[model samples]
Target: MKKLILIIGLASAALTFNSCERDITSLNEDPKHPTVVPSGVLFASAEHALLDQVLSASVNRNITRFFTQQWAETVYVDESNYNMTARPIPRNHYNRMMASASAVINSPGVLSALRDARKFLEDEGVGAVKKNNNIAMIELVNVYAWANLVDTYGDIPYFGALKATAENPGNAEIPYDDAKTIYLDLIKRIDAAVAMINISEPGYSNDLIYKGDMDKWKKMGNSLKFRLAVTLADVEPALAKTYAEAAFNAGLFTDKSDNFGLQTFPSGLLSNPVYQDVIQSGRNDFLPSDVLVNFMNSKSDPRRDVWFTKVAGLYVGGSYGDENTFSDFSHFTNAISGENAQGFLLDYSEIMFLKTEAAARGFSVGGTATDLYSDAIKASMTEYGINDTTATAYIAANPFDAVNWKKSIGEQAWVAMFNKGFQAWNFTRRLDFPVFTNPAGSLVEGVPVRMFYSDQEYLLNATYVKAAAQKIGGDKVTTKIFWDKF
Candidate 1:
């Protein structure tokens, strides 16, 4: 009889077995393992994997916090200095998004699992309304993953990725897709997904973000559309303006309550990834970076009171990429470092800031740039629990700088996006604000504009990867993503 081993929560699992029939083909069937997994389980697992990879502070998988200089390494500073090869960071992220092979628990990946869920949902012949809403939710998540991949790597195997078959195995070489083309298509997908969301019906019941709340899902879809439009402002201004306005017309996150967030479990494999990295790891390799803290300190940002702990009665950060004593630097607050802390995917604060940028660029996104900017800051302050008086005062002091709106919006967006490393990195790259200097002993001369394609891709799909590298002007860390035209 074939043996089945189930792995659970980053640990080993052993299954009890009974004697099987004598037939060889019968031995292959494991009763404990079902041919089809419930769509909800696959969807939920996919969501967890997506959030864990994106929201994690793990040096091995993700280090965007260091890349954006929001956090600095205390000892092993390779990642902080733009070293892409020390670990398979890009590979881990890539796998989290597109890996097709299923684990013992039916967890494929973000795209793979969601695609599988769609297939299973179709196979089961669910009701039209429920199925449409479920499929829409899946598409929304797919769009988010695809956008993230395009933003990280200049080009990727889009149409060819996550589609393994009997004739075409998972390891088959796939051609790279143009990033701009992919972004345009993703915007279309978002629009379709939003259109399909029947608020009166239900969504994925196992959803970690909204718990079958199709209304919130619909809002998030439009919110995502607006964010993507803003990303294209420098590259596709007219298209960007049209979509931004369309997204506003559709609707968006009305307030903080509509933010897309994942609450951390109390314990086990489902615990907060941040808490796992900072507290459970039994290491002190990371601390807030001076690049961030000094900026926050300079503006007398009220959110700082709740973000970091005081050292010597003042919020102090470690010099970016420098080795420092763990006890000497300010640590992240309990609100962030606690085991049950929540990690956000999309925030109303971010949408408001996008609106601010859109208004600044002459897009009719519903308000003046100055008013929207203040609203963005106020939303961020409220999200962090700062009083209205303090928030208003801060906004008054740092009034919008129309001449340098990018700097004004980008810098504050960076602050507002604390702990959301990926979006913050996007802000820094697109807006080119709060300029970061190359860390001492760095791999590149300056901050990396895009993450290099996974090294494993070179070994596994050499020809296609080489073609992609050449198309993107070499697979170096300095290569800029398509939308980062500024």
Candidate 2:
């Protein structure tokens, strides 16, 4: 009888429609959930979320490692075989982009953070130089979020994404921007970000990536500019050259110390994504791909030991699209096993390789292809803790193939970025070297060049989503994204 009365009471309360006059009191404020948080807090959350996107190795969703062939699956070979849509990778990323990333732009907390920071600076009589520097620093984080969106999905919500409802009441769908236009705009924003940097201004102490170091942030901004510039090298040589030279002059990652990546914590839910997936999850779903281990073994590359643990004195790997026993194949070494493993967004080795490629095309990115090529290899070696003597010997053995510098540089870059599968995949798509074989007669199609837009997105904005798919060659995994101009 008491339970029945409680149910009746719940239904009665649910049916009672309270108007603003009666219910607009403290009822709206839930003690457990605050309506307001710090902007620094929101920024930190977004950064942490972005790190998850970068370090994602989940077989069901992530396609990056599959694209790079760095690691392969032991079971559930769908991702390794290029079956992206079979899972929710696109939806997951799209949601992250729409929610967490968009919050950086739309949330009141973030807006207040930026506004209050600028106001504080203004009140301190901090000149325009410092103020602009501060704004640029924040904008750098914005561009980083934007870059991930562009690189993964190609055309996406840009001009109208995340606008306030007042700006566009009942806004159901946002328009999309093509990759080319997005790239150009990002370059412009980066240029602004770099220009506004006044080292004298204080860096945001809440910054997790650079710890409020304006110089490091400045290098990262310039590095990003150059990376974007290089991505357009094939289709827009003029702009590519302009931005490349500008980025070079502006400065870039001089060493491994300058890499723009997250140094994950040793505790809590914030452990390195790879470590979280592999260790804490207690799942050995992945092993080194045969393509990766064989390539390393073919040249006796010392990075093999640094990257993987030998199984029975052999650095063996599974064939693409095939499964191997967890113990039969080499597993990832301690380099990426710890909670504190560094998850790099961009690294010095990649910058060196980019310079090598630019020099190959006579873009004057500092030195000959060979010089930059050697330095790139050495940088990778140094980053992996290989000694100077060993690095020099390896470089001596593998002089830049003057006859085929493109393949040489591309292949070397491919090896240098062992764990960073996203950039590795992008470099492969752009450079088109070390051409990989299709996943050994996988049940699905060939390796995906780009991911498919989710059906949910399609249904939500069928017209524009379909238009994007049509523009990008029918939304298939086989379709090459813009800048993948092979």
**Candidate 1 per-residue lDDT over residues 265-352, each given as its tens digit:** 5566667899999999999988888999999999898877898999989999998877888899899987787888878888898999
- Quote the lDDT for 14 in model 1: 10
For all the candidates, what are their Cα RMSDs to the real structure?
Answer: 4.9, 8.1
**Number of the top-ranking candidate, with lDDT as the measure:** 1
| Ten contiguous residues with the weakest lDDT in model 1 | 11-20
Candidates' TM-scores?
A: 0.93, 0.87
Measured with C-alpha atoms, the lDDT of residue 310 in candidate 1 is 96
Q: Distance (Å) between predicted and true CA of 168, model 1?
A: 1.9
lDDT against true structure, model 2? 0.71
lDDT of all the models against the reference?
0.81, 0.71
Residue 287, candidate 1: Cα error in Å is 0.5
Report the lDDT tens digits of candidate 2 across residue range 139-169: 7767776776777778887776654333333
